[model samples]
Target: MGRTTWFDDDGLKKGEWTAEEDRMLVAYINEYGLGDWRAMPKRAGLQRCGKSCRLRWLNYLRPGIKRGKFTPQEEEDIIKFHSLLGNRWAAIAKQMPNRTDNDIKNHWNSCLKKRLFRSGIDPVTHEPVVNVKATSSSTMSSPTLTPSSSTTDSSTSSARLLNRLAAGISSRKHGLDRIKNMILSEPRQAVKEDKLMISSKEDEEEEVNGCFMEIDDNLISTTSLDELLCEPYDMYQSDLGHEIDDQLDLFLEIHSLGQDLS
Candidate 1:
């Protein structure tokens, strides 16, 4: 092959970055603030190409760049936002501070697409697909109900048969109508369910507090109301304890709800 007629003089930096290379780039950028990268190497005394220096600074040395695995909330936010924004990955990444566009893009391809499909939504359209059963039923049900009954002869018999047919169809329509209502109303139903739950919880809290107040009244009758009220003042003085207790109570309630929902 004659080694493809070799030529020697090189200007471009190749291969992976070493620790010393990283340190030098970081230190140079930090100390001098990035000037022209095309001229940065010669100015900063680095043995790297401009492209290499630019990539290192952008992908690694940039301040406020978040690292580590994203939390579930971040993942959800990214999905929801991208669902709205499409592939404005950089804009989506901006909203989720810890996530890069590259990371978000990868997660969308690897994970989010499956999640969307599993949730009954088309990943591309973000719309729910009608199930096969629903489609078939709708098609079959649409016919059977003709506009005129009198046009067919045998007046009495036709009337009775028409009534029966109408009833059967009305019943089927009512059932299918109910199903369609459920399908269309699911999102609203979820909102209403949440509201009802919150209302019920508030009512429960009110009842519990009323009982607690009755107990407190009895305690005050036996002891002193002023002393009991003042007890909490000294109790809240331990800032760490107050924080811990609040967190414990919140976690307990959230844990109960999570278990119930699951």
Candidate 2:
């Protein structure tokens, strides 16, 4: 036997719901409360499907529904929750009080993804998105899980090396404090290097043109030797002559060391 449809020919007024239909629905539900949603449209004199009416009332016409742009904090919470929950928008929305699942999904697709990309995060993976310093697409994928077992092995080894370096530094030791200071000083050191490079280049150009510009050795510090060695760092060695092999080695070592320590 064929399943009978709930909607009757005489039951429906057969068009979009009017103000009268909405009022009737509101009055009926207020008096009787919602029961058997498939039977609601006929009982309440609405033209729309019972499913459609229920959705419209719950999502759009609900008394305490909030309809507006999400605040920055709300957006951040949504992103954090989404990173953990992975598209369970309904569950996330429930925590957001008046916000709907549809709203959250649209915001993620249209806005949040761009924000994540701008902040150097992989929107899909929710991990720090780094530029590939190497040429191969293999380098584009995460070092932890690659098609090449050798690559994975190398990555693991590199992580161990980094952990050793980290373990070598103790909080009570002056060496650890020195390293922390060095790390914090890196940006300032970079800016100083840029200024020195620019000044040196300008002086060289002036000298070649039979003019003189004052050169100052005091402008460049001898203290930041490591940072100076890695000056003008860019992905794929755009500024410096960073080799693809070197880049791969660096990444593998870093990843391996990280894993080892953890």
Candidate 3:
């Protein structure tokens, strides 16, 4: 029944962090930058472990950390953000300034859970509970396109990625195939050809089918996806340039799910 109180060593202080502890920890951090977590305790003359110190500073003692009851608008934003991200508190917290991941998570558990249920909405799925049951019934009676909450979430993420890339490419067009085509414009033909016939060895073929494809043309050294990415293609280039791998990964994931990403 022993707990992970920073470690089993009872020498380190546990439970609540005191005012003096907070003041000392903060003063040390201010005078000298947060150099290393493990070494901070001894340098600051604190009885607390590094992990505890770190969490305390981040969640409670951190400057600019917003406190008090969340406003109505903030509550609505949290619900919308939860629907998209689920339990990714850190991701949800990024949209919100002056808020910690721990704070957002606590608010959801204490306040939003009851609020969603009061509205007859499933807190986990963010869908109407009655509608969920109705959807389930119609799905058995006829064909319902709406998937379960889990599947819907994954599809939502993928769709967002596609839409983001498409928006970067063109304001008007966002058809799935068009975005897929532009994403695969690098070496897509060679990838399709690889499936039918292989000019390269079987061992090397797997590497050919990644974020980018290489045909192993003329054995003039295997070209990398980096090389392909280095070259500019207007359609695929945008503010989303940094997220190319993420875009590619999602595209590849959907392709693996039996969709023709060509």
List all candidate RMSDs to the true structure.
23.6, 21.7, 13.6
Model 1 off-target regions past 4 Å?
1-10, 131-262
What lDDT does candidate 3 reach at residue 7? 27
Clashes of each: 0, 9, 0
Q: What is the lDDT of candidate 2?
A: 0.47
- Top-down TM-score ranking: 3, 2, 1
Position 55, candidate 1: lDDT: 70
Q: lDDT tens digits, residues 84-186, model 1?
A: 4455566567666656777787888788877876666545434443442222334343211111221222221311222222222222333434433432444
Which one is best on TM-score?
Answer: 3
TM-score of 3: 0.54
Q: Which of candidates 1 and 3 reaches a greater lDDT?
A: 3
What local distance difference test score does each model get? 0.46, 0.47, 0.53
**Residue 12 in candidate 2, Cα distance off native in Å:** 7.0
Per-residue alpha-carbon lDDT of model 2 for 22-136, expressed as tens digits?
A: 7888887887897888888778766667777786677666678788898999999887656544455675676687888888889998999779867766454354544523323
Clashing residue pairs, candidate 1? none
What is the TM-score of candidate 1?
0.42
TM-score of each predicted structure versus truth? 0.42, 0.44, 0.54
Which candidate ranks first by lDDT, i.e. highest? Answer: 3
lDDT of 1: 0.46
Best-first order by lDDT: 3, 2, 1
